[model samples]
Target: MQEVLDALEAPPIDPEARIALQRYYVRCEMLRKVDKRYSEDGRSRITLLVRTIIESEGNENALVEPVLVAVNSVLRPGWTGKGLAFIEAFDGFPFVTTLETMRGLNLFKEENLGQYLGMVLHNRLLSLLGPPEALSAEKPKRKPARPLRRAA
Candidate 1:
């Protein structure tokens, strides 16, 4: 994936974030190689990467953008399970805060990449925003009772 490589090469705004992104890029490349041979092993490796990204501190765009680009490669059409697993791996971490910066990036320009990622990250976003109750302080209205129907 030239896109992924380009993202990895792009310098991050923060020096520390850049280093972290570089380490992740190297690990991702290694995992991709292992994944080609082992096949089954790719799931766990991707999960590990997802966990590491979410657990990482700071909201630097430099770090978030490339990491997501690299990860998105594995989240293709045939990898629905991995996408779901990726969301599960969030485990209460508010990663969407960091991901917000990526919304305007070009990485999502790829076909359905943005939509696919949106689906994968939907659960995490919901968690961050909380239940519908939290979204609006107003009390929910109760439905009115319907008139009873006559039996034949």
Candidate 2:
């Protein structure tokens, strides 16, 4: 939403941090695209994996192990290898957006993780496709001044 975009554009943060955050946002959006293509059961399993990852609180090893298990157990047959590959490729860092999304959905109170995941995924997709001009903080353009008229 505009709120998130505005937050990204807010001043005073370290420029490196801002860039990193934007990159993470893009990565999550990419993951969301992959996630959205899953079948219903696969999506449910992915939601569970996301919950597990969030609960892991950035513990890389803790997140990876159980996710591997879930990938093998919950994903569609023969997709386990692909799922594992996806995890390996994308799960390098704990995404702040994922945590915020989990909190926003109140994952603890929700029985249906799939719906929440869908909401987050859709938001990310929208962000990815949002106004390209708004992606960065650019200084406002000043109109050119008219040539000074000669005194009549």
Candidate 3:
């Protein structure tokens, strides 16, 4: 779903994010296979997602941590927690500290990780093509991302 949307809307896949996303996709499929194999053998849905996430991503600090923080922090419903490393790795792009930037990003969804990723290939596509008025000072103001209080 998000993949098509993001591809149509996004600029281009960041090199690092692209690699991680690919790994995630592969890992997810593999885990699904394992879970299905076990389930057919009469086992429950095994917790293969995490291991797959780690293996495809290399490590939390190397991959998932930063993306998680960015996703959690920027999305409509913000999120937070310790060892949230993806936030650091995804520092590839600035302004991502704000959720609105992500929504504005035009990315697609990809499979893997703690949750599904926005797989859209849209790069921070600057308005290279747009109405002349887009650059006007009269442009409407955008809503700011509100920060949630960290739980004690």
* Candidates 1 and 2 compared by lDDT, better number: 1
Q: How close is candidate 2 to the true structure, as a TM-score?
A: 0.24
Off by over 4 Å in 1: 1-12, 37-123, 126-152
Clashes of each: 0, 0, 26
Q: Could you tell me how far off, in angstroms, the CA of residue 137 lies in candidate 2 after the best superposition?
A: 53
Q: Candidate 2's residue-wise lDDT over 68-142, tens digit each?
A: 332223333332334444334234434445444666866443334334444443344334333212323457799
Give the per-residue lDDT digits (tens) of candidate 1, residues 1-152.
22443433432334434454455456657776866543434334444444445533432232344445444443433333444544444445444543454555656554444355545555554454332232223466989989899998
In candidate 2, the residue pairs with backbone N, CA or C atoms under 3 Å apart (3 or more residues apart, or in different chains) clash, namely none
**What's the lDDT of the predicted structure labeled candidate 2?**
0.40
Question: Which window of ten consecutive residues has the lowest lDDT sum in model 2?
Answer: 63-72
- Candidate 2: which stretches are off by over 4 Å? 1-74, 93-97, 105-109, 118-152
The 10 consecutive residues of candidate 1 with the worst lDDT sum are 128-137
Give the best candidate by lDDT: 1
